[model samples]
Target: MEDIVFLYRLVPGHVHHSYGLHCALLAGVPDEIIKRAEVVLDAVSKNNCVERLCNENISAQDDEYKNAMEKLLTFDIDSGDLNLFFEEIFSSS
Candidate 1:
């Protein structure tokens, strides 16, 4: 015998989910950015991050770096089902 699982259809605006990376892929957001997005996603999911990963591949170094890092850290990817991880990051502000 097989166990049955129930799945409900997602109603418009009723569910909060972020598939930005998936959408970015379809919208041709570029391979490097997509890969970076995946890295960021993994970091968000795991709640652990290392400086080296964020420091290496980014092309800009000034305000872009600061802003990007801030936005990247604040993004809530857990979809209301999990707790977000917090940590001290590199910031002058």
Candidate 2:
């Protein structure tokens, strides 16, 4: 939960707020699952930061820019049925 809150603070206004809420809900899961989700979120965050930096420093048409973006596009956060997980947690409580 602490990790999720910390990550939420780093989110930009342009990004959807639901991701932060999702992360907060994810915090209630097992430690192993939370750790894995955290890793994925961190990677996505880092990728976004790098994309922003590249956008400022390089031409959008440049190969480097395209490659960087492609990498970001390929990132998948298939943590599986997060809604179901949340439901189980809430029902159990």
Q: Top model by lDDT, which number? A: 1
Q: What would the per-residue lDDT of candidate 2 be over residues 4-85, giving only the tens digit for each residue?
A: 2444455545563346545555556667556556666676766743223335335634755566556446544485565665
Cα lDDT of model 1 by residue, 1-93, tens digit: 674444567666533456667777777899987987778777666777834544533445656567757766777776522222223334432
Q: Show the colliding residue pairs in model 2.
A: none
RMSD, each candidate, Å?
Answer: 16.2, 17.8
**How well does candidate 2 match the true structure in TM-score terms?**
0.26
User: Which regions of candidate 2 deviate over 4 angstroms?
Assistant: 1-27, 48-93
Residue-level lDDT for 54 in candidate 2: 38
